[model samples]
Target: MQATDNVTLDNCADEPIHIPGSIQPHGALLAFDIDGALQAWSDNAPQLLDLTLALGAPLASLPLPAEVHAIAAECRDLIEDGEAPAIALEVAIGTHQFDCIVHAYAARIIIEFELREVPSDAVAAFALKAHAAIDRFKRQKSIDSLLQLATEQVRAITGFDRVMAYRFHQDDSGDVTAESLRDELEPYLGRRYPASDIPAQARRLYIINTLRLIADINYRPSPLVGRAGAAPLDLSHSVLRSVSPVHIEYLQNMGVGASMSVSIVVNGRLWGLLACHHMTALQVPYSIRMAADVMAQVIASIVQSIEARERALMAEQSAAVRTRVMETLLHHDEPARALLQHAPALCLSLQAEALVVAQYGKLMVHGDIDLALAERMVASLPQSGDEIIERSALGDWPEELRDALAPWAGMLALRFDPSTSGWLLALRREQINTIRWAGRPDKIVRVGPLGPRLTPRGSFDEWRETVRGRAVPWDATARLAAGQLLGEMHRASVARHVETDRARSQLLAMLGHDLRGPLHSINMAATVLQHGGAAGTMSTRIQASSGRMERLISQVLDMSRLNGGLSLGLEKNLVDLVPALQDLLDESRIASPGLRIVADLPPALPLMMDSDRMMQVVSNLVSNARHHGAQGEAIEVTLAERGDTVVLEVRNVAPPIGAEMVANLYSPLKHTSVGNVHNRGGLGLGLYIAQQIVHQHGGEIAYRYEEPQVVFAVSLPRN
Candidate 1:
């Protein structure tokens, strides 16, 4: 005997249930080798078949009818070709009829015979009902509807006391989703069963053997008598395989005398079961059982179709959101800011309670979250890779993080790209799940006919279990959508880097070209002073060249600091903005002799600001106007106070900026030649740096084209 034949509570999972070495007493089993010599026979075969058996006698020597030999020949060919499970036929022996099932395995032919009194009309009647049931199934609009109708039809066709449509969850637990029962029976709908009820090995058998029946739980088992040193038969696909003792005990405890289950296999996986139970021993004929099996297969197909359609719809919605986010990234220079603008929509699409984006060393969050706490969560993730981390509950988190993740239990984090130091997180709030199980799942050890073993629990009363600190489990579709979104985001990030590199190359080219003139002028002036010719003029020329170089280098440095996420280091003091503007305009006229600079200023509009930096802001705006404005156009500068707000406006007359240039106005190292009269030669960092500086002073800056003039405006609070 195998070690699992005498199983204990701890080793129940190791039981080799497929090779039980026996068959249920309702049928008789016979095995013959290729030479037609009887090799194995069940003990009850003599009484059930009314025949005498010999250990090594050929099947042609037996008293069985000649028809049996002819049918067996056809079955051997079909089995060898993998065409069907087995060939079933009704045969007569003297005055009795039996359902004969024949198949071949290991070069041996196995046959099972079960006595039946089926009438001629039964087959035609079941076929008609089966066709009608399938026609109605095609009308079902949803899976639940189809399943409920299926349970009703199976119960009607088999005359069972109760039938239930059960579905398995990702955790291996099952729920009775639909049921059809007699009016007097108690309802089992909406009840749940724990994963322990169906062990892993049992589930594997279910997938292989689609239909199983136990005529009577109390019936005795008939042991197979084999030749000496015969190997135990593998009865995984046997029609009359005996049920496990523990499983029989389990049904007995549920007050069921006979039971049947048809597996619902979807895409090669066991999705659920069609369970039927009888209050008393009731033997269903093989024909009716086959009909029930066909119904189950139909149900599995319909379920797969409906679920696929729903998942496709969800994917379409997710794709729409992805498109919008990608467009925002392409249009805006700052990815973090652009993503934050669509946080609400993204959270909704992902079915998440909150969202966090960490990119470019900046943290952006939505839905009432602390920045420091979010940073901590980001730090806990691996520094690189596109690995995804998913957690369904706070209890699943590390002990140190459990308390911190309270109220927010589920987390789906994606570290999409190794090239970028960033993470995207979608969070769900804690949801308390209340489950009502059919019984307490824990088994009790008891001494029974088989020695000490774990027995099924005697009580099957309704048991309620409260599960805490968990959100609704994320389904496979949601996880797939998350992966798709991250992939798109990674691609967009790579594109941004490529564009930035191109801009840097352009800046290097422009700087090299512009700096050459200043250096050449300085060298020429130095040589003139060395010759002691025009000493004052050479000194003046050198000072002008040095000033130009200083301005260009300063602009580059400011842009670099802003790009690195560093502060401008403002030193604030209560200052008069009116004087700052006047000084800027006065310096503008001196630098550009032909350009007319006009100002509109209040006598004294005082505010808190860094005087030098604030002046630099105005100076850059004026310089940009001078370079890009129309020839001989007056540059207008205005400063005023409007109810606790100080306003600054610089206006220049020029043609409207091109749409492409306007879109990338604040991007660094841009070069554009609008017209011959307008001079645009610089690193293109003036507006970008000016915007950053104004943002540091708790102010707003914006640009607009008003008819014949292009206007740049800055607004700061007067405090």
Candidate 2:
């Protein structure tokens, strides 16, 4: 339908396009009663069949051939079951041969007769023709080309004088988008038609049936013989249903004697109509109509595919544009300057004539447009939120803004953030278009002999009208890409906030966590000295606590270096890993009398590593094992030479650790709490610092849960 929010259809919505009660002249129709008695017949039927009007005569006694009787019987069976059936059979009555279609409708049995032709190989020829037509549809590269090809192929198969692909707008009005016809006929392509031509009921029927044909519009109608208590027939599904008198007049007014229509459905909705028109009587077999329906289906499928491909292509291109714009926004400190510098390429990518950037309350205008008007427009639009994707004509805007917005006809605005209201607005200058209607589209009613009657235009002359105040339409793909861009920007904005918040939080936690142990150690030593403990013991306590604080400061420095992606500045030396680990083990044992420790190592196995850092890595592993390991199980440290590498393995027994907790231990400045929060003293950066030191020495450190043992393995390059 038309993209405008205000849709007006005049009398089109009320017109009854269906319920027409007349058949075309090319086919004669007869209505029969439940007893197979001829009750009512079209005026042309009497002359064509050489029979006089005998209202109550049973059709079986009309002296027709046996085939006609059998056709009548099949029709009766269908009628009894409330089914409308089309049966094709040859009839010979008084030396006259004809092809008859016996159809069963509610309240009456209608028989339609046509002059049949005998083709040498109709089935084989039709199959080949259908294949060729479908191949043509597959080869089309665009929706326009495919629609044009479809009409041409349908015309070739059905032998209609003219065929057109008519597309319906959102308001139910339509235009002939593509047409193929005899060279002698006038073209109807691009001619607009009002929705009254095919009302809601007709559109619904087309969706269900897919095909309908009026062999000849000039024919008289056969009235259904009414039973005493029967209601009118609901002929909505009848193949040979009579056309409404209004539709009959409409066709005759258009000078179309014969017509047919096939529905093009896409995504389960009626997308458009493939209409066929003829100047004279025409008849096509049901099989031919079936083939045409298939072609219409193929066209629908291709339309959906082309639309999807276009969307995918738009998204790919939009992503590149968004990425470039994002980079500019991130690097440039000024929003207005960045927008102005990128406006040309950005407008081109969005197909906009002007661009506007509204950040906070400040507005910036760019591209070809009135600067004052754009600033006002951006200022008027909402500064925050991405909820509504507003698109409207300039005329419909507020009176205050409309006068200033004269330079453009439409505006599209999107807010990237709710708090800051970072909005991006695009504007398009008014696009004036000339539309051609089949006739005076406004004058759809004609004052006729009896009354004011609704009819198709009597003339096909071009009636042109200039359309203004509307911009070039933004397609679905463009809208989708715009939405995606806003989403990306919103995510980026939130991430920046989180990053800033995390930096502040990390600094406070670091000070508290790193100083807790040192202050506690000093207080304990002073308390011992005041209590008259031996001077040597108190001195040793003070020295040990002081040494521990110095080591912690060193670790904090190492962590800072790693955060900046700097090396540990290793002091490498040939050192025995076994002895270094042994020294730490002995100290831990003395510190914790209840600690269980074990060592399995080859004596004097030396390796080149940062001697001080290697000792720290071993010490951290041993400390972590003692704190979390099973209370009575041995904390084992194994060192060996494996090929060209020195491997140090520490094993402890503990409960399974959660993945999130393990991640927290390795991540920077991340802790549930400081000091005793982990049920152990000191900061939570030991393993992280150890891993960095190992990396600086060109060695590897890894952790794994080994059933009863939680294993930490360190492999150093033995050079």
Q: How do all models score by TM-score? A: 0.86, 0.58
* Model 2 TM: 0.58
CA RMSD (A), model 2: 15.8
Candidate 1 has an lDDT of 0.81
Candidate 2 lDDT by residue in tens digits, 70-149:
88888788675555557766565554445677777665676767554535267348757988989888988898898998
Q: Look at candidate 2 and tell me the lDDT of residue 543.
A: 83
Candidate closest to the true structure, highest lDDT: 1
Error of 1 at 533 (Å): 9.4
Best by TM-score: 1
In the range 1-719, model 1's lDDT, one tens digit per residue, is: 22235544445676789889899988888888766778899999888778899888888787776777777777766665333357788888767777888877766778888777667488669767877898898889898899899999988888899999889998888999999999999898998987767777788889988999998889899999865566776677778889888899899999998999999999988899999999998788888888888888888888898999888888898898889888888777667667778887777667888888877566778887778878877877767554788888876677787778767888899775455566778989899878888989788876666566778878778899988899878788889888888888877878877887887787778777667778899999999888887988998899989898888888778877766666677899998878777877887788779989888888888789999998988988888888778889899998878888888999999988888888878877666622222333346777777777887786888889998999999999887
Error in Å for residue 408 of model 1 = 2.6
User: Candidate 2 regions off by >4 Å?
Assistant: 1-12, 15-17, 21-127, 170-173, 227-231, 319-351, 382-386, 444-455, 500-719
